[model samples]
Target: MQTNNTPQNIAIIGAGASALFVSIILAKKGFHVTLFEKNPKAGKKLLATGNGKCNITNKNLSLNYFFSSNPSFIKYSIENFGYKEFLTLCEEIGLNLVTNENGKTYPASLQASSVVDVLYNEALFLGAKFSFDSKVENIDFKEKAHIISGDKTYKFDKVILATGSIAMEKLGGCSSGYELAEKFGHNIIKPSPSLVQLTSNDKEIHTLSGVKSEANVTLLVDNKPQKTLFGDLLFTNYGVSGNTILDLSREANMAILNFQKVDIVVDIFPTLDKNKLLALLEKKKKILSGKDKNSLLLSLINGKLIPFIYKKAKIDSKKYFIDNLDKKDLQALTYTLKSIKIPIDGSKGFDSAEVVAGGVNVDEVDNKTMESKKQKGLYFCGEVLDVDGACGGYNLHWAWASAFSLASNMK
Candidate 1:
């Protein structure tokens, strides 16, 4: 608490997750907090999170799920304000949180608007002021921070940049945060799309559009295996989507930005090895010898994928009968099933990305305080920093943890 008779004024530049969290905390600390949001309503991005269910945080809070230029910079904040602390904060704000079996947490009501309404109301109840539709154009740092928004200039004892990243521009994402940080002599790692769909140039793969399956996806960059994951995979006309693709998209997009050859090897039958799959195919062929060769794989895979598989395996469905399938032909089919490589052209970019992979470099920011080392009284939290997390509520957790760290330590 301040010994000064006058309450210190603090301006937060965004009304998203971190901004709201910090506003509530600062207001509780007896500081006059004001949130400047360009959107007419608060939590525009927050409301869209987790498909409107709002994954608040994850039970499995670990550094392994997050990415950054300096990965360890997030360790302090996350450790200090982990899941239990977040739950306590939520409870104090009268927000009930529930966790799924996979450890993804959401509001007990499971309505994203409920979470936003509770947080916004709590901040308002704490006497925090909001400047909706007020986009901060610039901040002049001196002994006091002067926030310029259109024709008005507001002075503050301190300013926090919670403006988020340039991902999902349609959902209120912008580059102003990076621009502000750059003006203050902060280094920014080039931003790239993460948790986004990966596009492929393979026309045949595009023909498999609307095909959904569970598969093992391996991301190969420059002909070397980078990462592998298994989950639901969806084939789209543009490219591939699903939890697996989104998970691998970070590394894939990073490689693509660097002009590296990227490909994803999708194993349609993840449960079966090549030899087992071959044996299964051979067994099917022998049992259904009288069936049309084109219909042989109907039970094994989606019917829409039959033509693609046949084309890739170099087996002519019109020429070869089920009984006439040679061992080599069966082996080729099995190989194609196990290793269907799709050449990645690019990603859907920031327009459709869930979160961006880069922002103001974390090395210049204090991990414990969320304060900029380059400029005192200027702080950062949430996705505005280079730190980002994997899908499944990790990103939102970072927002809460980083906000708590900033609010707890801000003087």
Candidate 2:
């Protein structure tokens, strides 16, 4: 894998998965590698992934699943060090990965700490130097070094910037990567929070707080279906938020920012056809003609959404049975269950996104080695780049692949 057949002294600018992984691979080859992080420990964000399970990679891997300014650039890294290589690296580092029901790989111990521990320990074992509480302030391209904590400076022949984007402010993420990119003459895409929870200012969200349902959510960009996600969706006082909403958050936010009305289409019953749902409802209405709609509806749904559904359907809580049902009325109920619309007020901000979109434009960096075209002996990787993938281990996969690219190209 080391085509260069030699090691290079490398200074990794961040202690995140991207920098740690590249240091691990390069140091294992007897390269001089030093990883710098402002945090007290490495992999702070790593432990928070997958709600602590740390979804390492997904089974469904394809290039179409990612978004980038230069779409073709990610093809090289992903093709070179795809999901298989990530698993292999875990095992090589003495961490056994176990696959979940959804094909998401996790540490066998089910502890995210185990994965972070392995990466941290492996890097150390490979002779990688880690300097915690080392914040890199400005970069000096002319001197080939980074200014740390506003004053301290770390010089190197080759530098890898992987501090990540401005998402997750609570987790200590910022635009240091962007600042470094600008210092090196690289163009940065306007950063927007991605993979974060959406919060609406609408009062209807209050009615459905804590209500979750199996639904098909479609993102309507200018009332046109841009993408659709099928999964479990949960609603809160903010808005509809879940893996489903997060999947389409970028587009939804972009649309909302453009002053276009953004709406979420949730089909609570995607499997049941209109006629089937209508027939079942009709039969149920006949069976419980005397029962009030409030109680009967509770049994129909998951109980939490009965009132919300009634309000959405404009159905009277006490109305039990309509003497005669017209096709249009039946259609209205069917449509209500099949296509529920919710407005997107805004996202919870960058402090909560799993990954941020819009980074250093990918076209400025060669995916083959993650080297920046704008600067010599400088490489970029991880969330610092524009390429971002859908949820389910895709972002982690990018980190692994980009790191592998950098390590393999050492000379």
Candidate 3:
């Protein structure tokens, strides 16, 4: 604890979640903290999170939810600063928090600005200074922290790099964070867009566009099933987007980048087995004997998607009677419904990505303290690190947890 009249000067790059939280904590700890943000305002991307509701954290935080080069890297920070601790801080700061059925925690007001406002207010009250529109072009750490922004130079005793990732460039995302880490002897994992929509070359996608179905999606890498996710899959004009697609996109994007054959297979009827579906279809054929094939499928599937399924199953759309449908037709229909493969060529890219998959490799940073192992006084936190979590407030939780860990270990 510093009892001296002069507090130690600390500089933080980027005014995102990690930087803001740490600035508040360090300022309260008697450190002179200064935040440099390239954007005119802080937390611009934060306001876009949870569709602008600002999902602050998750009650279902675990190692499984996080993805990294070292999966266990998040354990120390997350365990030290759990969800309850963050909520306690929010309550103390007069911000109301509410957790939904999915364990996603948000402000009671449900306004993202409210979350940013409270943090900004508390940090300012604790004497933390903010330098908006000051993009740090170069950083020299030979002695004390020397950060250069255009013609100006700012020096501090310690610096924290929280520039985040290259996910949402419109929200001030860039490669500067990785560039700075590389210059400081840190190896960066080739960053790619994650939690983004997957684009398919399937011609049927256009026909099925705007149609949503509760289904199970299986990600296939190199023609083999790698993982499975279940949710409402939304068919867009370009491809698929939904909770499941976003969840599987991290791995899918990586596979696509590696030039591997990536595909998404949807089980449109997840609750029904192949036999059950076949039985149901047989019964439908009998009950709707005089109806057209399209009309027979209206109650069974999305009306717009019937043509695509029929095309895949090689069933003629003009087949009006149940007597026209043979055993082979029933088999093909069942197979197509159970295993609808859509070839994923790429994603909607970083602009649409919720988060990024790669960053400064976690091995180069001490998970316990969030301090750079290569540079003693330099620290890292949040999305800038390799750690990324699934959707539903996991990434925000990591930001708070990692920032808390960094602050706890600060001198």
Candidate 4:
């Protein structure tokens, strides 16, 4: 093993968020760091984050924000590298940040490219080398660390795998990172598409396509309420896509993999309960006694969605007058409005997924340093690990946190 004071040769695969962060840290720590990216440019996915604004980090850093097969695996790295330290480093590297009311931090310039540029510039200035269009194909860790990319082979004292997951192929996401881990005797949890749009077979969903609403979404796995999230939801010809659905999708993906029943229960009127909504509808019915059922819902709900809502309640919009509606009709409408269950068959797949849910099992990696337990001089971090975070800036936080932890322990 190299001594703490000695400069070690380090190889990092993939040029995503964690790769860049760890490379910057280790290079500044006097290590000779070389980042190998398959793509012509680094941070291709990073450039697309937060719609180009780049949600860099969250002010509230907690273990609850992250998900892993080993749930507590993120605590050590996160405790070592919190948002304050990350923000300080960002400032030192000349990247100004702004924290909004929601505690989601972004570049003051509001450009994801700006964040990536600052990180790349800092790493380069610190003497870190970058090899673009260099996709690593093989790793021979039998004797020394030898990584072969095509015909060329590079040896290193230590290698860090920061290659993300098989999500968003448009951004160069692939399974090479997981294959590397498997070669080193690490077990990988089968990856599934998370934070992606849901696909449904419900024909009614097609009619309400393009309709957006603020709603509470609950994911039911095996007929149990696994999780809930609140945000804006959008109906598409495919199915449901939005902040709320993406937040709840991790559980949906996992459940689908288990062959368990998966369903999305959306409460479009989350602020009002069943009884309250029923009372409101009753009062409205009295006022609009002569009007048709469609007219009564027009002022209260999205016109495009009125037909679907009434149909779910078993009420005929064409025949029923507001006064003719019975208790059963009101109850059905209340329940439908409060709990509109949409059966999710599958996701949009990795091509449309924002992040993947599984990776190199965290049990095979050290939480403190993100070093692989199965091999010396090998490390893992970011989405390549089992750890994944919710939407907003949590996933980026994991990247920085795990990278910082690994770099600190590199000799």
Best by TM-score: 1
- lDDT string for model 2 (68-149, tens) is 8788988888888877877777777898888877777778888888889988988888789988888877666565555455
lDDT of 2 at 333: 70
What local distance difference test score does each model get? 0.92, 0.80, 0.89, 0.90
Candidate 2 least-lDDT 10 residues: 317-326
Report the lDDT of model 1 for residue 98: 92
At residue 357, candidate 1 shows an lDDT of: 95
Worst 10 residues of 3 by lDDT: 290-299
Stretches off by above 4 angstroms in model 4 are 1-6
Instruction: Work out the TM-score per prediction.
Output: 0.98, 0.94, 0.98, 0.97
TM for candidate 3 is 0.98
Q: TM-score of predicted model 1?
A: 0.98
Error of 4 at 33 (Å): 0.8
Model 4, 257-335: lDDT tens digits are 8899999898999999889999998888888889887776786778898889888878865666777788888899999
RMSD of each: 1.0, 2.3, 1.2, 1.6
Error of 2 at 12 (Å): 0.8
- Among these predictions, the greatest lDDT belongs to 1
